[model samples]
Target: MTAKFASLSCAAIIVAATHAFHPSALPSSSRRPATTTTTTTRLPMSFMADSSDYKADKSDFGDGADEDPDAAPAPLRGEVDMADVPVTEEIPVPMSRNNVGNRFLAVVLDGSFNKDDAKDAWEMHGDRIALTERHVMWARKQNLYNETFNLESRADVLWSHQLLSSDLQRAVGHAMCIDSPTIEDCREAISRDPIVRSLLGVDPETGMCDVSPVPLYRWRQIRDHTLRIDDGRDGLPNMVMAFDRPEAISDGLREEVSNDHLEYLIRSERVIAAGPLHVATPDKTDPRSIAIGTLLFFNAVDREDAIEFVENDPAARAGLYETMTVHRFNSLDVTGKFVSENLYFPGQNTYQMKEAMEHWGYPVDDLQTKWLNW
Candidate 1:
């Protein structure tokens, strides 16, 4: 329900907690000039939550967007007043693979802002959450009719109705979803054929090569609610579906199918944002293995809807993936409205950043070969 007041509900103006930035880590103002980083402070890119009511006039803080980065503090208004917000932090990239404690299952994002280009992420909590709620409902219904597909298949068509936040909608690109039941049948076929196993890398024991579950550094509200990452330039991408190619299928066939497959997805309106994984340089291998791909869906009203979409990808049809998973793209914690772009790393050029996203399986997956040209 929309927050309403007799005129404007107090609920509409609910206060968020203030986030503390290590002075050294505060994002540099975009309007200023700075070529090198000169500080090292540790503060989670997210903010702290506060519920105390605010009584300040709008003129006091200027809605937090235009707050002076150098201002000592505004003259106290009355009771409680919100503080200033700085640029968004760098992406919270998880720590590298290791074996420290529960490190195997834990993910830690690189949370620092020492670059001039780096800024905070935008906040549209009210809008994004509405998208999530509608999705949960869509998933429940599709899961009922989707028993026939592989557990990991993204059932996109289940709920034809889609709800998306404006930011989320803009970031979606071509996507292919796949997971299928024939995989079991393929398992039987491979067991009887050695050529198939080696070509497809099918384990005789398990037919699917297995989509390794890539644990991620997920973020949420300082109060523990999840958030979607929107580079602020592009829309906020809130969902991701990850799938890997099994050795069962040849790379040659998979690539051939993807040309048609991606086109089909876009025409079908199945994907909002989607793309395939590629190497820094084109792979010369005949049948290349697709490390992974991500899809920010448009019609994923439910889990089964998401599964249906994945199950239908042409690559999946060609036996490309071993496993797959779909879930919220939890990228950062939030308290108040963020004023700057928070989804990037400082000092990293867009070219380098695009390549680095492959580390998280998000290389501007459009499959355009020319974009990689130096």
Candidate 2:
């Protein structure tokens, strides 16, 4: 049931915790500035919980070891008025992935935004979440009747339906993937997504949205130990996804050195998912589709570590890519679910693709010529 507010003035305003700098946010001629970064700090505020209710326990402060007699006595905890306190109402945390199906998933987006529009795109959270929840319900129903194909090949599944927050000017740093039954079904659902249509500008002539499906291939589980520790805070991005678009004429160099880059990632043992992002094709079997770029999701000590990891790759060293954009990523899953073990992609490991290929009846030789050659 939808909750109806008495009036728009009484409705709670939504706040974002992070921003993103998407490469697509800039025009081709105007290049994005490069800079190293750590995770942004999460302000202590939320609409879901009231910190104003916090009670002070003098015992918890350990009796001020070096008390300053000259300092004025601190104000009583309960003395301050609530209206006098400043607070930033940030969005509440989304559901955790632990309780949901551990199987890998995908999300496809159909929309367009210009470079100048990035500033205004980040607004609107209440309406976006409402629309997003409705889309998730519709996707779950579609999965029930979907009989053709499911990437997970499971009897029951929960699809992820969440919007990404950007810390930079870009509203959407990267596209997500949905585990729909078929490519066509996924595209149809995205077209009807109210949030996507409303947030993105449409082409005047074509009157259509630009569609792109990012199929995330999880190579291993998230290694929290390998990630850089922040100020012991919650709500920080635990992983990073770097999207690299190869130069128009560097296909030969990319293909020649792709294997080396894969080998480097496998050796590091921190790769969570890595694969190509392509233009939406008619179907998976279509032979006419061409490659547009590649995506790398991995664990790193910090943003700098991630940048160096991708920059040192054979493809990057060889100048095969025209641009690479790295953004902190957090996968939003179903809420109320918690698990101890963090298994990103179950029953598969990039380190042992040889055995996985043989187990699935795929030609092992193609692992070198085709799989790693992306």
Candidate 3:
């Protein structure tokens, strides 16, 4: 949060971040980061675990997160009533497998605590609103697509490695460990994050009793495991915007428009990552083509520019894409760096006698290693 943050050693950052958000483990009970609310009073979403009937559940996509989304939604798992919830378990709580049993509770407690109109869907859909705003701000601060870069030709290397380096990736990982509410060591990891503690509805210096804030703990579990993605300016794609091609679109039209647009986005260097989804199954004759909309990942500042580029695309104008969807994307493997290795697939699917994946644009040019500190 300050110049000191950047100077902090990895271990030091973790310690500070942890101590800042998790005040419950502090030496004295009064030092917790919470308001002096009656601990016994039932808070929002604290309902009877059982005998709490609800309308018949609607079907949802099952293959969530790591798997296919078209699959039927996994059956609801675990009890969500504040009373039945357990925060510190030896086995550790999971994200997808973990579900808030009470639909009402799920609706009321989705990682956000608005002082006014508590039941409003403000934080639902994965804190979509807050994250979106943060993303735009991150991009702006990073100075993406600034005047100097915009004036320069697309061919030149305009992006700076200052924020996109491997060291930053490790820094983000450390930040994530600190941010993660579900991480096994999070009790020690979070101490008093000023921003996060406020959101948890607790005093930044005086945390509430461990047992009383079940709602906060429950929501904390959810928030901790939500995702590890950062805003695009940090070189971590917080959102992935996908466009799908309609079945009726001809190859000629797709080639005439989308292909060139794809090149423009790739060369413009405004995006953290972009790719076209193709049949990854056993059926693809060619991995490059399957007629799907492109996926572009950018921070909030680039939102308008990204949308404009997509909306003005020849294919989009021609009504080739049947549907468009923008959803949050967190890279579990990439960490926070944009290393050359991840820029493209490692091996080729060359089925013609010999298939091999090759490098994209000659490995990142004398890449500087943080470990080496060259």
Candidate 4:
């Protein structure tokens, strides 16, 4: 399972509160001057229905009636078949509870300490054990069902202070709503918001201050309801283990992984192991450092293949890992409700697309006039 960033609605109260109190805590105005506020943009009613009602056609643009003749063709819809794409090997789709009917169990580990110790903790945790069993069972069932399952693991150790600001949080939300170069840029924009800075208690001079603990770090690891399925097994891959403190992973080790290999693992189709690394340093105002290190898994044959690959690797075979354990987990309530909504993606045909673009400060005259007939 990949870690998901928080959604705008989940961070709205945090951003609002941060801006209200910590005016000086925002980023340096010298970097980018603050601007006047604008009215909130509302989406069109036609496209705002819940995801259950969503019925997208298999075309590049759903029902392409609203597409502009000159606009470039839209990209393919849904996930691409790995077989169809070029790669060193065939990437099998991940199977999980959402794909099949089996339940998913996750075990998160702390990756900041010794890899051996972290592994030990997961093994002792019964819940984690259960989760692993669930994954195996789900995978077996998928095989019987003539389906595929994908299992993967991950570690989340990248906790930048700049990204923690409430303004940045809100900007991320808005970015997902509109368009932005990167999530980091969206965060930078939010950092510029005076209101957001005030609320987060940012010290403008030093560009550092005690921001409210909104569990943003915690939320990031377990938001997003839709698990990234590698195949269509529904429940082939179903376990995850995230390791944190007291589990033996050290801060320094996790940082090394974060700065080196974690992000790549998060984006790959394998289970990840490592954790208890800190997101922030313990300080006077806020003593808690965001614990880094986590594991994400799916139920796919490829999962076992990846594990085999790791076990066969000289690095993993060298007994680098010391202790290991597992903890079973219930469902993670990550916030991706918006993405799951039918209105989540406003195609070129809808007025909602224009509204969203304009809201993001983009010039949407072409899209607006063409599709919305504005």
- On lDDT, the candidate that comes out on top is 2
Order of quality (TM-score): 2, 3, 1, 4
- lDDT per residue for candidate 1 within 95-162, as digits (tens), equals 21211111000111111111232322222233233344333333332232212222232222111112
Query: Once superposed on the true structure, which residue ranges of model 2 sit more than 4 Å away at CA?
Result: 1-22, 25-132, 135-174, 180-182, 200-251, 334-374
RMSD of model 1, in Å?
25.3
Residue runs of model 3 more than 4 Å from their true location after superposition: 1-240, 245-251, 286-289, 299-302, 327-374
True-structure RMSD, every candidate: 25.3, 20.0, 30.0, 23.1
| Per-residue accuracy of model 4 over 1-374 as CA lDDT, tens digit each | 22122221211222232111111112211121223346775533334366455333434336567778699555567534445654444223332222211111111121211233433323323332334333322222222211221112111111111111222221111001111223232234334333333334477688963323322222123333343445323223323223332322443444444433434444444432222222322231244544433434443233333233333322223322221111112322111111111222334244565565355333344321232222
**Candidate scoring better on lDDT of 2 and 4:** 2
State the number of backbone clashes in model 1: 60
Order by lDDT, highest first: 2, 1, 3, 4
Tens digits of per-residue lDDT for model 2, 1-374? 11111211111121111111123222122223444467775535434355455433333567666888499767654455446555655334322222222222343221233333343343444445456545443344333221222233222234342323333232242244444334555555455444555555457897775433223232122334432233213222323333334344344655786788667766766665566544444454445334445655565554445556667767677665655545555444422122211123323435464464345333344322233211
Candidate with maximal TM-score: 2
Better of 2 and 4 by TM-score: 2
Cα lDDT for residue 219, model 1? 15
Error of 4 at 35 (Å): 57
Off by over 4 Å in 1: 1-240, 246-251, 278-298, 329-337, 340-374
What are the runs in model 4 whose C-alpha is more than 4 Å off? Answer: 1-235, 242-251, 270-285, 290-292, 302-322, 325-374
Query: How accurate locally is residue 179 in candidate 2, as Cα lDDT from 0 to 100?
Result: 42
